[model samples]
Target: MTNVFEAQWEASQVEAMEALRAWAVAFAELNQQMSSWLDLPTTDANALGQVLWADSSGDPLSPARLGQRIGMTSGSVTVLVDRLEAAGLLARSREHSDRRRVTLRPTPAARERARAFLEESSAEIAAAVQGSSAAELATSTAFIRKMAAAASGATTRLRAARS
Candidate 1:
């Protein structure tokens, strides 16, 4: 009893979901490759990536903030930070107004390694999307952000339900 418009909308939704799933798979593969190239486990690489992103955004992460972002315990974060620091991939400094707070930053070597590994792929991705109209690209960006928000909200709800 569905109308033609409803059917078409449903088809579009299905296609969007499939594309999102494919994107997730591709992202995981990229993470795996990066991890291997860095000679670090996936979790460590992910934490490093978070630190790099936060630093690049001009808000470097404290250990506690990094733990919250990565869903790790404070003790676990300490261990991870120690490991990364020992490997010379990360550095911790008390640069905040409150000297007690330690900020995490990726070392130059880590940044160079990541840039070397990702520059080509990043450029290719930009090239692939360059043909899209500005409006189309904006719409796609908004759609991805909406999808991410929905997924994150669902995760929060599920965690709350468990608690």
Candidate 2:
């Protein structure tokens, strides 16, 4: 049911996706190394990144939400939060009228440190894409987003099956 051109195109697409996956793995390892440089565990670094992302999106994270994002248990997240708080990386604040609700916010020091640590890599990445047109960038962004959504969906399905 497939022509040669179609088959070749599909094969090339698969190869491209595999290359992207490899890049993702390398990026994750780089993140782990960065976390080590900051004396934080990989999970802690992931949590902090998630918190920062949420804040940048104008929706701060609560401990429960942070745990959900990171696939951590509430108890584990609480301990992790405590450690980060002790290290002056984050703060837990009662921002809501509901006194029981607590928000996790990255400290200014943490933001500055993360920015400093990432500046070099960020510059390199930006430079790598410096010649891309807006349409190309948009297409790449959409493709990556689609891949992320597909991966997330697969994870959810796997978790449901396990449960």
Candidate 3:
């Protein structure tokens, strides 16, 4: 039964997939809630999140790069940035060498609010995973990293196929 299940049923794989789907839904809900709480459009909240993440990572993200990451058009990104800047959630600065090049900067107030929004979920996740051994956590990290890469490649292939 084990061999047949492994070969034909994909065994417990479907259960794992169901869990992953639920996790994905939870993440989407988090984004939706964050957007609502911020009184911002989902797209704008996503853009601000990207800017905050980049700034925290010590890498300044440009509008073009953020648009590319979020699959938004240049014109749409321009409009989004304008709206965010107007909302005091973000600021833009021109590159010293290339005055035409604009980079996103998250306001401290916005970053603090974003972190506050995420804190409860972060704490929950930490508590849930706290029982994992070092080796178990390492294995989970590797699995998730590989899954992310595979998912990214699948998205690229799907986009190309659509094109």
Candidate 4:
């Protein structure tokens, strides 16, 4: 018979793997919706989405930082941002304090359109989750947080190593 600790460890591993799989599935579904909503090529949609979801401080994200979050390289980020800017979805700006630092921000139109799309998507997701039991919802919420934290930590380490 397995010891209690061993059983608990195995259960934890299973839970972690399951959570990862669920996150991948949810992300894929969301990606499909975003692709259709933005009417953009996959890469462009993803890059634009990252800009749209960024904080509202009106500060631009560095190309390197954007690339790290979007799973692309600095060069690719530059090209992607250029395309987005050309399409009027995003704009490039240099900080007044440090003109050497370039950053990207989405245009007002892009932000409005993305917000509508996300609101509809969120409503649909909420409706579906509402059917779940409270306990199930709680478990799912906890699982998502745990998995997101794990992914965020991994991405941080990867970016640090690259820098």
Q: Judged by TM-score relative to the true structure, which candidate is superior, 2 or 4?
A: 2
- The C-alpha TM-scores of every prediction are 0.87, 0.85, 0.82, 0.71
What's model 3's overall lDDT? 0.85
Clashing pairs in 3: none
Instruction: Measure candidate 3: CA RMSD.
Output: 4.4
Using TM-score as the measure, what is the rank order of every candidate, best first? 1, 2, 3, 4
Prediction RMSDs, each to the true structure:
4.1, 4.0, 4.4, 5.1
> 1 or 4: which has the higher TM-score?
1
Off by over 4 Å in 4: 1-9, 57-60, 126-163
Best by lDDT: 1
Which has the greatest TM-score? Answer: 1
Model 2 residue 150 distance off true place after TM-score fit, in angstroms: 1.3
What's the true lDDT of residue 65 in model 2? Answer: 91
**Per-residue alpha-carbon lDDT of candidate 2 for residues 12-66, written as tens digits (9 for 90 to 100):** 6888789898988988988887788677889998888888879878899999999
Q: Residues 2-68, candidate 1: write the lDDT tens digits.
A: 6654554677788998999998999889888889988999989989999999999999999999998
Candidate 2 runs further than 4 Å off: 1-9
lDDT of 4 by residue, 1-163 (tens): 5565455467778877876888689987788788899887778888787777674755457778788777887888888888888888898888568998877788997898788887888886778788799999898789778878988997888878999
Q: Could you tell me which residue pairs clash in candidate 2?
A: none
Q: Which sections of candidate 1 miss by over 4 Å?
A: 1-9
